[model samples]
Target: MYRYLDSRPAGNSSISLLARAIGKIAQTEGDHTTAIPALTLHRRNAPTKPLHCIYGLGLGVVVQGEKQVMLGDAVIDYGPGQSMVTTIDLPVVTHVARASFHEPFLGLVLTLDSRHVVQMASEMELPQPSRGGVYRPISIEALDGPLVEALARLVGLLDEPALLPRLAPLIQQEITIRLLAGPHGSQLQHLVASGSPSQQIAKAVAWLKQNFTRTLHVDELAARAHMSPSTFRQHFRNITGISPLQFQKQLRLQEARQLMLNQDLDAGNAGGQVGYQSASQFNREYSRLFGTPPQRDVRRMRAN
Candidate 1:
């Protein structure tokens, strides 16, 4: 179990209020998506197996309990009063690390609009982010009083359905402004600033995701991002914590798994659908990543 210590006096009240609100709504052990299209609340009563998925641009806040997320070799653990911001889409493994019947894991994720971020950055006249340093796509930091208050108010709006249409956008904007002005300012700026390394890599990532089923040529991808193959490879690995080939493999395997589970496709068909030409090689890599052969893994997932 994780013990939470709130050192900020002003934030304690808001955090408590937010926790209560989340607990009331997330009464069961599952994910709850509210009327706010971009917001989702999560609840878990016990530790869970690590699940793989793609995390897009969003803000995640843990009002109670603890969770862990793994990006390639990087592992991040965060608890109450801590928030994580992901500026680019990345494949990650995540699980609830600590929770119990008495104190279930409670958290919320708010999808961020990159276009709005660009508009706000322009209006704020924030300087361009530094280009020389390493900037990971994801960051974790302690939530400040203003951000927590804004989030609490956003959740509080759920009580008034009529007011949500009128007020949610304003609070969401406030949350975005706070994030841009907080410790994550530079990272967010890097994501939006034109021709920045992070932005360039983001473009390459977007291309890879859209064309994952096709053959990938490193030089072609690099050229599309206006980077040399070597520089693009380095920046991609630095930001996403995985080489291009590894990233592509993850995408293929994840998609194959979904096809097998949802479409009732056989292992061979799913593998071929995801760009694998050799059945033996596909089964080998599928077992390596998912810890089971395709059919068996699908069965287990369906059973759960």
Candidate 2:
């Protein structure tokens, strides 16, 4: 069984308390989804290899241990008393940088609702995010006292499931309000503000995610976002840390891997399912992204 270090120094009390609450429910090494919608508890007893996935809009708080997220050429590392907010769906390579059997990594993620953010920002009448400044969809901020306390209270609600359905939303709202009023607020504001470059690029990203298997036409996508192709390309890369075509390819490759691993589909069929018309091209791209041939990678993952 995992035990929280109650004897830890008072300076770390808030994080330690959150870790204790997480340790109680997440006794094993994996993601635990709670009855509280869009909330997930994560536990890892040891360090892990790089795992690539799409991180949707959410707030991730690390109560214990450390991790890193790689986006294109950017690398972000965060640990205890730190939180990360991703304002858009982004493909990232993430791994635990620090963890141990005795002191496992513990964390939680709460999905953010864009519509709710827009509603709150409007009511608050916060100043518009500065224009033309490149704001990556993800950012890190040290957790302040009030925000940390609110997060701890949110986890505490699990002990009283009867009150969760009613209280969870209120707590989640508080968390959102804090985020909007905090350092990362500018990025969230950029996401919802009308006609902002981030907002326009976000719309294009949504369409690409939904139609990853379809052929991509940069001009058409740019027009959809109401920008010239050149401007759209620049802003897309600025916000997502990759070109639009690269983003779609990553989405395709990720879905293909999932299909192969979960449904036991063959490489060629999986490739076709994810918009790859040529088996050779798919093999080359798959090997490039995953560091191994499709079959070999699948076998290796299963063995692990």
lDDT of 2 by residue, 3-86 (tens): 111112223788888899999999999999988888899999999999889999999988889888888778888888888999
lDDT of 1 by residue, 117-168 (tens): 8899889967667667557688888888888888888888998998999999
- Residue 49: error of model 1 in Å? 1.4
Q: Which stretches of candidate 1 lie over 4 Å from their true place?
A: 1-10
The count of residue-pair clashes in candidate 1 stands at: 0
lDDT of each: 0.88, 0.89
Model 2 CA lDDT for position 78: 83
Error of 2 at 81 (Å): 0.6
